[model samples]
Target: MVSRQNIIRVADFIDSTTRSWRTELILNTFSKDDAQKILQIPLTHIPHDGFLV
Candidate 1:
């Protein structure tokens, strides 16, 4: 489970980002599972070239 601090931080970050920047912010900050709740863009899922699955 993500700590309250983490959740709060994510919420704070998301709130700071406008709609136009939300996708980029989420892509930069969250893991796939973490991204689940904050998904705002379909194209931001750049799960990497040699990134381990």
Candidate 2:
């Protein structure tokens, strides 16, 4: 049930919370971990446009 509005809300939350220096630092640090998880996905499960569900 993930609607477009939910995506917008999540984007807004990310934008608002990452404005501070500390939060930005934490996000930057964890970005690599996020990338690792994303990159570890199987090719068959990846969308043609590269989005994951």
Candidate 3:
């Protein structure tokens, strides 16, 4: 099961993207993964590239 904090973190990450509509569209195009490793990182560790790499 996904944790509440992880959900919030993912949402914030998505919101921080350049365009919400594009972000949502791209996210929807991909299959969901409960083990999104990046989301497991502490917010402080997120890189400037925004984990797009």
Candidate 4:
């Protein structure tokens, strides 16, 4: 059972990382129940040299 605090932490981490990379993070939750559809997506971009390293 995932706790709400942990979920928020993960979301915050993802948001911070995306901001650092100058990208957008899109989160969508379908429902509020435990069986929720959550997605953390970061927009793709053409990585410069050494960006993937």
Worst 10 residues of 2 by lDDT: 12-21
User: Which structure among the candidates has the greatest TM-score?
Assistant: 1
What is the per-residue lDDT of model 2 for residues 1-53, given as tens digits with 9 covering 90 to 100? 33334444322323233332233433444477874554344333222332456
Residue range 1-53, candidate 4, lDDT tens digits: 33344555433323343433212222222243321223334434433333232
What's the TM-score of each model vs. the native?
A: 0.31, 0.27, 0.21, 0.17
**Which candidate do you rate higher for lDDT, 1 or 2?**
1
RMSD of 2: 11.2
Which candidate wins on lDDT?
A: 1
Q: Is candidate 2 or candidate 4 better by lDDT?
A: 2
Task: Report lDDT (Cα) of residue 36, candidate 4.
Answer: 28
The lDDT per prediction is: 0.47, 0.38, 0.41, 0.33
lDDT of 1 by residue, 1-53 (tens): 33435654433443333323355556566787776665744333333233333
Candidate 2: segments with Cα more than 4 A from true spot: 1-30, 45-53
Poorest 10 consecutive residues by lDDT, candidate 4: 21-30
By TM-score, how accurate is candidate 1? 0.31
Q: Residues 1-53, candidate 3, lDDT per residue (tens digit)?
A: 33334554444444344323223433444445633443344444244544543
